[model samples]
Target: MAKIVKPLSDQQLLRYSRHIMLPNMDIDGQEKLWNSKVLIIGVGGLGCAVAQYLACSGIGKLTLVDDDKVDKTNLQRQVLHTENNVGLNKCDSAKQSLQQLNSEITIDTHTIRLTGEVLLQTIQEHDVVVDCSDNLTTRNELNLLCFKTKTPLVSGAAIRMEGQVATFTMDKDQPCYQCISSMFGEQELTCSESGILSPVVGVIGSLQATETIKLLVQIGEVLSSRLLMFDAVTMSFNEFKLNQNLTCSVCSK
Candidate 1:
């Protein structure tokens, strides 16, 4: 069943006036965003940035999943958490921040790590899924689930001074994360070990948020079938075409 979009109130029009004034995103596009639901995995650096922007932009519903707690180390890049939130569950802490940004939007928090059937069910409920998780395992799982369900996914990753963002719509000709990951073999680097630049995640995360909005509003060219890479050291942005793998273990079926 298709969800019916409610008429925007005067307050909503005023709140989103800037967006409504944009030629690409007028009232109709803003309404589409107001009726959309997005699930964000991992409330880390990338997740925090993505949630913050979406919340302010008025995404109807946001589900934040993360089992980890806020640590002192996260303060540098995870802007959604503060020193006072240290030791608190990341999801709860993020909820507090997002609510402060936009109390009108509904925010759901999940404190436990998502896996198995539970994860699949959660992904099935949302209009779009944003992958902010760090591990290849979790990324692969999300890609497979999103592919099976035909949900659009905005994926981002950052390590050291490099970052990348991609969108997977599970289109027949589009490649899933597994297809891209397979080309590079197994990933062994992590932000904790490699030390990511604070702004790198922000850059990639912001792009993921932009892609999610574009997908929901049905406007502009999304990152689908393409990968956008950023190098903070050299301050350069590059894009690469992503090809579907017919024998991809996750999306072939």
Candidate 2:
């Protein structure tokens, strides 16, 4: 069943006036965003940036998932949390921030880690999923779930002045995360261990947000089938074509 979004009200028209003025994203695109639902998995640097942009953009329903609590260490890049929220759950803190950004939008918070049946149910509830998780395990799980459910996924990662963003729509001819993960073995390095530049995650997260909006509005060329890699040291971006592995387990059918 398709969601029937109400026409923008006078306040909404003024609120999104700049967006409506755009050639690509006029009233129709803004309405599409108003009716769209997005599930964001993670509340760290990437998640914070992604959530902030999407919230301000007027996404109809934004669900934030994270099991961690805010820490003093996160203040540097986790823009959604302040020193006052240092002890609160990341999802709760993020919800507060997002609500403050746009009171009209609905913000849902899940403070538990996603897995098994819960993960599947959550993914099915949203039109799109954004993977801002840190670990390979969570990323792999999200990839499989999105593929199985046929939900579009916008994935982003940042660490040590390097960042990458990709979109997977579960198209049989397109490459999924599992296909890309298979190329890079099991080694995983986290920001705490490697040390990350603050703005790197911001750049990647912003890109993820852009891709998400583009996907929802059906405007512009999406990042699907391409992996965008950013190097802060050189301030350059490289694009790589992703190939689907026909023999791989996930999305091979």
Candidate 3:
């Protein structure tokens, strides 16, 4: 006889009943979610949403990495934090919120800055890596690390009224984040200067969580070679095709 998969316990069934009811995310998908592990590189605006959704969605383990502390300004787009969390490390606040959101899943917090060697060590432990960082420098570093480790990376960014998301796989054909950055250059605005809408970040971050889940469950088509761009002001969505740059320092490796 084929191996029998255990059914979810009553409490777990109750907690994820809605997801269990969906054909796409039935018990099997939920089981896959429950067994998958994801590493989120930042606990800011995008990380806040990505972590919350992934934890609540039944991911088995999460490793959060961030070096910043909460401040009054982060309240605008960093919903996982609050006024009380000011001066506290973002990882601490995120852990508090995630534990409250779902105590069933385990969270591992890293309160240190991510650098070359450190980044590689962390990516090796998780099944997928989510880049919720805000700067191009750290973003490129993470892309290189993920590619070198042969890990799937779900990269998302939001600023002003626009946001973009893409999944980079280390299959040699997919356009990595470094490739995209080289083509577009780092001409985008930052929230510190240009500002961002809270909901815009929320929308993009939530999609990052969705993409992470899809990649973890091995369900649906992963956004491996396409960029999903959203413009909230016009409420328009566009997908631009992306190819692995032959000269890409990261992807070409």
Per-residue lDDT tens digits for candidate 1, residues 1-253, read: 8768777889999999999999989999999999989999999999999999999998999999999999999999999999999999999999999999999999998999999899999999999999999888898899888988999999999999999999999988789998888877564797788898898889988999999999999999998889999998899999999888889998777
- Kindly report which residue stretches of model 3 are placed more than 4 angstroms away from their true locations once superposed: 1-8, 186-188
| C-alpha lDDT values of all predictions | 0.93, 0.93, 0.89
Order of models, best TM-score first? 2, 1, 3
Model 3, span 69-135: residue lDDT tens: 9989999989999889999999999999999999988899999987878779889888999999988
Inter-residue clash pairs, candidate 2: none
- What would the per-residue lDDT of candidate 2 be over residues 1-253, giving only the tens digit for each residue? 8767778888999999998999999999999999989999999999999999999998999999999999999999999999999999999999888888999999998999989899999999999999999998999999999999999999999999999999998876888999988878678898889999999999999999999999999999999989999999999999999889887788887
TM-score for model 3?
0.94
Ranking by lDDT: 2, 1, 3
RMSD values, in order shown = 1.0, 0.9, 2.7
TM-score of each: 0.97, 0.98, 0.94
Most lDDT-accurate candidate: 2
- After TM-score superposition, the amount by which residue 36's alpha carbon in candidate 1 deviates from its true location, in angstroms, is 0.5
Please give the distance, in angstroms, between residue 135's alpha carbon in candidate 1 and its true position after superposition.
0.4
lDDT of 1 at 252: 75
